[model samples]
Target: MSSILSGTPIVYFECRQCKCVLQNPTPDVLDEWKKEHQGHTVTETRKYPLFDLGYNDLKKAGELAQIANELGAVIADIRFMPHTRNPEFSLKHLQEVLGDKYIHVGELGNANYKGTGGIQLANTEAGMRILHGLLANSAVIIICACWKRSECHRVYVAKEYEKRYNVDSTPITRTSARDLLSSVEEKNNPQLALW
Candidate 1:
């Protein structure tokens, strides 16, 4: 993993209060990030798609995991009760495929799905502990489908991490599995090629 993102005093903050994600991530920078982390392990977090209703299905998550795996990224599904809305797959299925890389970091377990209520969950002690434990000292990439940077939950997660660790979590704004894979595909061949 490249230390450039972690080595700097400047941390990236994605403010979710206003509903956003990591400000604009330059194409060159994203390409550089991909190049810099050639062999380093990456984690692709699978959450219910923010705007896309199709990705709420667990199968899409598995598809994304396959792409991430091909690109050397481990699948980390942070949803605890992923079956509440998506029952096509079970937790066992995710664990079976993701293996040791699967983690259930349900930061929003107690919060409402409407993004209201418990807005301060990240500021609570338990929330801080969970966020810190999952993010501290580790480089994280937040993925979501919001075109508006300030409206991405991945950005929200990053902001929470920054609030606690005072460090930046890279945010990648892609709306679908294909788009996510394509973003990397634009930078590197075969690695992101899933067609």
Candidate 2:
């Protein structure tokens, strides 16, 4: 054998990718690293996480609202058009989930299906002030909407915060209520999947 064997070695006895003739890590070394990693763990915990309640269907609102409550989030309902005629727009379930923290702020007009008007409204100076106030009190602000995160005006609002406040304002998007619920459940039940 040469003094230096540098290449992707095919043998299991040798390191696979390193450009050296080093032997493969022994099982003892691997176990020691695993034990060290397990003992010295570092986890980041966020005080508050913004939740966007993006459910247009009233049938599922109650379920999503419960999940949001379990996750400890505030709900925001954005209605551009007057919801006087729409009983579903009352969002009673969401209000119950958020309690006094529920806030509804938007212009009175026809629903901006294209969402351009909503984006503009959220990007205005007044809009920035309201968002700033929300951020001041809470570490995260949850935007409850009837659409996905990328398509919702809440994303625009987050970006506006990033621009005006010069802060990291990336909002987490929950496309599926089931997904969020499952994730929260997993966090609570650590033994469910542990070997």
Candidate 3:
């Protein structure tokens, strides 16, 4: 039998006899552990939805908040430089709009965002740790500036997250945003649904 371990980093697995402790082990590592400890059971303790969205798609901070609220997720700003010409997207204003539900994980940001070198993580481990902490509580919606997921660095971030956490990221499309917004509107004004 495996003994439970607790700490700030959150232990994912522990073997008392072998003194093998895995902290935040990736899916592959967990699989290997299962094979090594044939009789031991490994169960996924928690699963939180992960999503990627572009602020351009939502256009307004309020809409972003609304979408996050609908999904019961925290907004993770993954922009290396979380500033924009658009006042609403600027870090301070976005934080103001999102309040406690917003967090800027700059470490996950692409340092070469402006260069042709492609996405480069600023601090992969640190960023992942922060995201892991958040995942323990609620779903996470990673946001970036680019409108297209294919052309955005957030895609790379989402990929990295999937690799580290073994979770698939759902790309929030424009249609989905519109539908969520429409739902919010209808909920706010029940009469709107009749039209």
Most accurate candidate by TM-score: 3
Candidate 1 TM-score, true structure as reference: 0.46
Global lDDT for candidate 3? Answer: 0.82
How well is each residue in 75-132 modelled by candidate 3, as lDDT tens digits?
Answer: 9999999989999999999889999999999999999988998788899999989988
Q: How do the candidates rank by lDDT, highest first?
A: 3, 2, 1
Quick one: best lDDT, which candidate?
A: 3
Ranking by TM-score: 3, 2, 1
Q: Write the per-residue lDDT of candidate 1 for residues 1-195, one digit (tens) a residue.
A: 221112112223233333333333467765565465555553322221111112332245566454544334333333334554444334676566666545555653324435565333323466447555544333222333234555435455556556655444443323344555555455578654455
Tell me each candidate's RMSD, in Å, in order. Answer: 12.3, 14.6, 9.4
Error of 3 at 130 (Å): 1.0
TM per candidate comes to 0.46, 0.51, 0.77
What TM-score does structure 2 among the candidates reach? 0.51
Q: List, residue by residue over 1-195, the lDDT tens digit for candidate 2.
A: 122111121122222233223234468865554455553432322223333444552345455555545545445555554243434446564465556666665521124545555444533566556655654444334444445666666666566567665555434434345555555566679775463
